[model samples]
Target: MKSVTRSLRILEAVAQHQPVTVGELTKMFGLPKSTVQRTLVTLNEAGWLRANRKDTTRWEIGARVLAVRPAALQGSSLFAAAREPMIRLRDTLNETIHLSVPDALQSMVVVDRVDCTHAVRTFHAIGDTSPLHATATGRAILAHLPKADIDELVEHGLERFGDSTPTDDGQLRADLARVRADGYSVNRKQYRPDVCAVAAPILDEDGTPLATVAASMPESRYDEQRVPELGRLIADAAKEIAARRNGA
Candidate 1:
């Protein structure tokens, strides 16, 4: 534990003076050169620091630490709560299953997912972010938010990420209004080309939106006659998650 704390101290010093040298680290931490070098080696091995071979003998943060974040986050941590339902839904539809929470922006944030059986399955790996105006998941949560919150997100401006992305404010408002009347949102290749999604709001007992759930599939395989069945699957799965969340 002492060694761990000491290594963290060295890391802190390195961060404070990033791209610093071993000598500089030794001086900053007032530790022996051997201790600094050993700590640097350990941190580098663990992907916490990078050793630059060029001038200044520079050591910087490694891609390991930055690219792959530790699974330490503060929140309701509800992903675990939905695992069973996600699996059930994945088997039920043989399509990709996704769950996300609302971000500060109008965008939907992917937090968890279950891949489909096919190699050609939709791949929305966890943590992928989706646009508010172009994704079923985003519209699901947005439809349930109050007018003021929706207005705040709209004021931030819509950013286009795909060919069919909706940046027009008036059209987006109309679409959201339709979502309110229909009780679900359907995004047809509006986010990714040739990709489509159906999403439903997961509500708490008080009828407030807590999160959104989506079932995504390829547009080529879409059956207009079967869309209602797909919507039923998504809506039912979302309700199961909501009940567990609200203890209803």
Candidate 2:
């Protein structure tokens, strides 16, 4: 409770008075300088805060925040960033591929998408939220989330989208643990009754899960024999995205 309060306070402070200094935050929040300094320093190191070039003494949100903007997806800005990778992955897998992110408290949506070559293939909603406990994209993002976020999400329980969607914590935890351990995630008909997908989290330099890249296929393409291969392929795609993102 105490830690949550402190982090929230820090985030609120930053959000409210974005370009603020450590001294100013300490004074406004009535927190000890030591405490305020430590929090701001950590945020800065995590790329959540940056020193203003106009005045090195002040800090504000950094480029990492800018990169996630849906508004930036217009024309050259959004497509230039994600189109090539989305195209290449779709081509290689011969399946629908998506670059998706959280849309609401419970759903994930595709901001960018590529259709598969097959006449009959899984389809995804470009601006829709896949289920929290069903899609590989959600699991991949959840795997890297802070413990509080995961626990809070599970307390809400899984929203059933299919017969296989897990509504229990034990199984979700096990699945998420495997995702973290293997650097990727896999889902088998957990969302749509006949759709399966694999996903991996794209990380920034600080190792924060920025977003997810995933491939959707029909249930017919799934089997233990092919699951591992799919996991590897999705992970490779995520790594490629991460490399390009970091470079940009």
Candidate 3:
């Protein structure tokens, strides 16, 4: 009984502070290092947790956890609110549309998606995760985060995923500033070499980001001249989703 309770508690903690290290979990629970490690290993084996892809020493939520949950949005209001707008955006642009929410400040997890009919469209599994510094979906949310939170994420180090990924703190901050000013973000093969995306955030009543909606496609299909139009469309969709979610 005690073991089960501890395991559940540890799982909740991991969900709250994902990409967390075992040493950090140990400190959080005030448990022995060995005990925390054993629990983490057990959870990993059970498919409730997995090591972070960028840093294997840290743990994050796994696909099975999302798979077993009802509708996989963790009961988020954003999912229901964004569904229609996401579909409309996909139909309008003929590109894949994704809805992602922050996993703490570590990464953005795809909670929902509307797929386009194009054979070469970009795709992300519903539970897939992407770095907050390197993807348009992530940058949209990151741009709205509190400065202290952004500072903490930057201090943790941004791992470069591709040539276009912003690794330097100054560059990343500049990119985020552009996102704030433009009301959207653009990713040009930043996270995935073949993909390009434009995204905007769904903000809560307090103007904090609740989720992001992105229109993604293969780099070969991206049109630089259409970026402003695409950005405006995505931003409008995001605003509509936010309004619906907030019952406004």
Best model number under lDDT: 3
For each candidate in the order shown, give its overall lDDT on alpha carbons: 0.77, 0.76, 0.90
Candidate 3 C-alpha lDDT tens digits along 97-201 = 988888888778887888999887787887787899999988898898889998999999999999889998999999999999999999999999889999999
For TM-score, candidate 1 versus 3, the one ahead is 3
Q: After superposition, how far is residue 56 of candidate 1 from its true place, in Å?
A: 18
**Tens digit of lDDT per residue, candidate 1, span 5-110?**
9988887777668889899888877888998899999999898898765753789866554333213321354565577898999998888988877665535667
In order of appearance, the predictions have TM-scores of 0.69, 0.67, 0.82
Q: Which stretches of candidate 3 lie over 4 Å from their true place?
A: 9-46, 49-62, 66-75
lDDT of 3: 0.90
Better model by TM-score, 1 or 2? Answer: 1
- How large is the C-alpha RMSD of every model relative to the true structure? 6.8, 12.1, 4.2
Query: Which window of 10 residues has the lowest lDDT sum in candidate 3?
Result: 66-75
How many clashes (backbone N, Cα, C below 3 Å) per candidate?
0, 1, 0
Q: Which wins on TM-score, candidate 2 or candidate 3?
A: 3
